[model samples]
Target: MPGNLIHFRRRVRSVKNIQQITRAMKLVAASKLKRAQDRIIAARPYANRMLSVLNSMARRIDPAQHPLLAQRDRERVMLVVVTGDRGLCGSFNSNIIRSAMNFIEDEAANRTLSLTLVGRRGVEWFKTRPWQVRHEFVNIMTRVDHRYAREIGKGIIDYFSASELDAVYLVYNEFKSVVRQDVILEPLLPIRRLEFEQESDTDPGVDYIYEQPPREMLDFLLPRHVETQIFRAMLESEAAEHGARMTAMDAATRNAKEMIDQLTLTMNRIRQASITTEIIEIVSGADALEG
Candidate 1:
């Protein structure tokens, strides 16, 4: 009983140490999440305005005016997979990997699809797979910047212009809330399905006079729009990752506390039983001597 008590006491101590580490990790993740959320909030308005402007322009111009707006046979495609650089988040990286695999399995029957990995986890996982990887940007989740998005957008645009790829898509987690994230597989190329929203019931449409023709404006704005979209997606993914990590660490800390409590309780019970047995033995020995 004493040995068992000692063992459980040691277990309790170990769990307490783990609980402390998890608590620290949770706090760090929460801080990071706050900053990421702020960045996302700051970028949303500009991103929305960019989309609105593009929608208006796309409606006015012909698809023939811009290669990005042209519809081509979905022969060759690119899947840009965005994952976190690190793990410890619950099912965050695995869900993305699973979704990417599903996409490849479904699309392989018809089209020639390749991958553009964004995070270290995705890059490492896809390396073992048979699919071809066009590019990889690893370790960018810690410090996501617009320049990285611009570089990726430019490469994709150039590749599409060269007719290397027929279409492009992005797969990432969209941060919906602190505890929830939605996996998104969004189309990035050929710029299909343009929808613009009106302000009020009285407003039918708002028109603006452009300094250049619609075609020329599209030629300039189309690339920026793609970059902005990619940047936004990266920002969302970063925020989602932080949220997932924070939630996971919080759960882990709670679990550790529970384990510690159970262990301590077991230890106490064993100690008490040992003490009771010793007392009974001493009393019986005294009675035997008296007899």
Candidate 2:
């Protein structure tokens, strides 16, 4: 009985220690999540407005004038797969890698499918595969910046211009809320212009004068638009990663607490049984003495 009690006590102590680590991780993730969420929210307005203007300008121009706006037969493709640097985030990185691989497989027939892995997790996963890894940016999520986005955007632009890659896509986790994250697969290069279903009846279309030629303006704005999108994706992935870590740690902490409770109950039962045995033995001795 004493041995069993000691074992249960040790198990409970071990679980308590794990619970402390999990709780601390949860707190740290929560703090990072707040900062990441703020950046995403703050960036959305500017990006959206700029995208709207770019789309309007794109509709007014000729596709042949700009290589970025021109669409061609996609014989070669690239996937920019973004994932987290670390694990224990509860399938956050796995979902992204799986989605990207599925797309690559689906598009693999007769076409060249390449990868630009961004993050240590993604680089590790794709490196072992047979696909050609064109570029790798590890630990990029440690600090999300527009400079990195510019570099990535420039590489994509160059690849498309040189006809090295026909199309490019971005795959990452989009943050919906603290508990929910959605894996998003979106096209990045040979930029597509978005159109709305219904036009506003009360709005008079305003035409603005441009200092630069229309084609020159579009040429500059198109790259900036791509860089903006890359930056936004980085922000979304950061928030989603932190949210996933926070959720995983919370679940682990709860499980640890439950295990500790069960161990404590078991220890109490064993101690009670040992006391009962002692009481029964004492009573037996007294009766024998009286007899």
Candidate 3:
């Protein structure tokens, strides 16, 4: 009984220590989530308007005039897969990897598939697989920035322009809320003009007066549009990862606390039983002496 009490005390102490770590991690993750969420909120509007304008412009112009508007056979394809660099965030990494694999498998049936892995988790997983990894951006999530996205987006644009890649797609976790994240697969290249018409908030019937030729405007805007898209995706993934970590750590901390409470209760019961036994033994000794 005494040993059990001692063991329970040690267990409770260990759980309390673990709970403290988890609580600290939860707080850190929540702080990061807030910052990431703010960044995403600020970035989305500009990106959306720019994309709307570009798409609107693309529809009015000739496809031959702009490389980005060129629609080609998807015989060769690349997927920019985004994942978290670290783990312990529940199913965040696994869900991304699973979705990517499924997409690769489906695409492999009809065309060539390659991956441009972003984040360490993606790099590690794809490197061990049979798929071809075209590019890698390790630890990019540590600091999500437009410059890093621009570099990556430029490479992708170059490949598409050179006819090395016919199509490019992006796969990532879209942050919807603190408790919900959605896996999103978005087509990046061959800008389908019609898709944007549905998403546009502006009047589709209206036209814009351009200072430069539409072709020249496209030359400048198309590349930057792609970069903006990549940046937005990075921001979304970072925010989602932080949310997942925050939620997971909070649950862990709560579980640890529950465990500590149960252990403490058991220890108290054992201690109470030991005291009762001692009291009974003393009473019997007194009776025997009196008799």
Candidate 4:
């Protein structure tokens, strides 16, 4: 029993150490989640405005007038997948990867499709797959900015402009709230203007003059718009990852605490049993001496 008690003490100590690490991780995740969430929220207004502006411009421009707006029969397609670089964030990475696999499986007949991975996890996940990887960007979730997004956007635009790809799609996790995120797939290129008709309906009653020709403005703005959207998606995914990690770690910490409590109770009971046994043995020996 003493040996059993000693072994249990060792186990309890190890679990307590793990509990401490998980608690620290939970706190760290919470701090990072707050910052990431704030950045995502702050970026939304600018991103929405940019989308509105692009939508307005796209509405006025003819498809034949701008290369970016031109729709083609998709002979070659590109899937840009965005995910976190690390794991331990519950089902966040798994959900995105699973969705990507489903997408690939659904489009398996279309063998001309290429993949563009935006995070280390995405890159690593698809590395063993038979799909063709056209582009990859890693460490993007660490600090996503417009410049990085624009670089990626420019690559997509250049590829499409050069007729390397017919259509482009982006898969990412959209942050709905701290507790909720949805995996979303958005068509990025062949700049679908018809989809923006609902957005046009909500526009304020105002007209603006274009400095350059509308077509010329679109030529410049469309690529930047794509970059901004990609950056925003990265930001949203980062925030969602942090939120998921925080929640998971918090739960793990709580479970560890509960387990420790149960184990402690068991240890106390065992100690009490040992003390009672010792007392009973001593009393019996004394009685035997008296007899």
Candidate 5:
């Protein structure tokens, strides 16, 4: 009984230590999440405006002239898989890896699809797979910025221009809220123009004076638009990563507390039972002496 009590106390102390670590991690993640959320929110307006401008320009320009806008028979496909660098987040990395694998399996039947992994988690998960990995970028989540996005965007653009890959796709977590992040598998290449629904109250036609030819504007705008999309995805994934870590740490801390409570309760029960037994033994000895 004493041994069990000692073990329980030790376990309680271990759990308390774990609880403190998890609480600290939770607080750190929360702080980072706030900054990430602010950045993503601020970037949204610029990204949306860029897309709108791209759509307007794409409608006027011929697809044949622009390499990005041209449609091609997808002989080869590239999947840019985004995940977190570290673990301990509930299912954040697993969910993305699973989704990407499913997609790769599906696409393997028809197209020769390759992977471009971002973050150590995805890289480690897919490194053993049979699929060809064109690029693997690890430790990228720690410092995500427009320059990183631009570099990735430029590489894909160059690949497309060189006719190495016919199509490109992006798979990442899209942050909806602090608690909700949905896996997004979206096509990123051949630059499809999104059609907007005309509002009844809006003007029939709106015109803008162009400083340059629409084709020239599109030549410049299209690449930047792709970069913007990549940048936005990076931001969303960063925020989602922080949110997931925060939630996971919070849950871990709570579980540790619960374990400590249960252990303490068990220790108390054992101690009480030992005391009662000792008292009974002492009373029996006294009675035996009297006899």
Candidate 6:
């Protein structure tokens, strides 16, 4: 009984320690979630405005006039898969990876697809696969900035423009809310027409003149647009990862607390049973002695 009590007490202590660790992890995840969410929110306006400007510019330019806007007989495709570097965030990474795999499988026989992975998770996932990896950018999830995105964007644009890759696609998790994230695949090159819902349109009776030329402005804007899109995706993925981690850690903490409570209850029950047994034994001994 003494041995059982000691063992049960140890188990209770172990669970309590795990509960503390889980609580700490939950707090840390909460802090990171706030910062990541703030960053995503702050970047939304800039990304949206950039998209609006690009849409306006793309509407004015003839698709045949711009190489980036020209659709080719794509024999080679480049997939830029974005995921988190770390994997404690529930199914965030798995969702993106699975979507990416599906995408690759869909494009496998149709076109020769090359990979440009943005996170360690994606890189590790594709390393053993029989596909080709053109480029990989690890540790980008730690701190996603415009510079990192621009560098990646520039390389991809250069390759695609040089006809190394005929088409480019990006896959990432889009942050919807704290509890929801959607896997998204967006075409990166060959700027497509912006589709919006039908609505009664009001025309501003004002026309603006271009300084240099529409083609030149598009030449500069298209690459920037791609960079902005990638940056926005990175931000969304980051925020979603943090949100998932926060939720997962919070659940883990709660589960740990519940487990500790159950263990403690069991320990207390065992101790009480031991006490009852000892009392019964003592009473039996006294009765025998009296007899």
Residue range 11-54, candidate 5, lDDT tens digits: 99999999999999999999999999999999999988987766
lDDT of 1 by residue, 53-170 (tens): 6776665556787788878999999999999999999989999999999989999888898989999999999999899899999988899999999998998999888889999999
- The sequence of per-residue lDDT tens digits that candidate 4 reaches over residues 1-291 is 898788778888988999999899889988998999999999999889988777765665567877888888888888999999888788999899999888888776865889999889899999998999988999878777778888889889999988888899999999888788899998899877744434455664343576888667777788778988998998999899888888888888999999899889898889889999999999999999999
Model 4 / residue 291 / CA error / Å: 2.7
Model 4: CA > 4 A from native: 195-210
Q: Could you tell me how far off, in angstroms, the CA of residue 169 lies in candidate 6 after the best superposition?
A: 1.4
Kindly indicate the candidate among 1 and 2 with the higher TM-score. Answer: 1
Q: Distance (Å) between predicted and true CA of 83, model 6?
A: 0.9
> Looking at model 6, how many pairs of residues clash?
0
lDDT of 2 by residue, 1-291 (tens): 798889899999999999999999999999999999999999989888977777776555567777888788989999999899988889899999889988988999789998888889998988778999888898889789999999988988888978788899999999999999999999888777555445668633444477988678777888899999889998999999999999999999999999998999989999999999999999999999999
Q: What TM-score would each prediction reach against the true structure?
A: 0.91, 0.90, 0.90, 0.90, 0.93, 0.90
For lDDT, candidate 1 versus 2, the one ahead is 1
Error of 6 at 123 (Å): 1.9
Residue-wise C-alpha lDDT for candidate 3, range 52-136, written one tens digit per residue: 8777776766778877778898999999999999997989999999999999989999899888999999999988798888889
Tens digit of lDDT per residue, candidate 6, span 17-72?
87787678778877887888899999999989987776655555566767787778
Q: Which residue pairs in candidate 6 collide?
A: none
Clashes of each: 0, 0, 0, 0, 0, 0
Pairs of residues clashing in candidate 1? none
Best by lDDT: 3
Tell me the lDDT of model 1 at 135.
90
TM accuracy, model 5:
0.93
Write out the backbone clash pairs for model 5: none
* CA lDDT, every model vs. true structure: 0.89, 0.88, 0.89, 0.85, 0.87, 0.85
> Cα lDDT for residue 58, model 3?
67
**Against the true structure, whose TM-score is highest?**
5
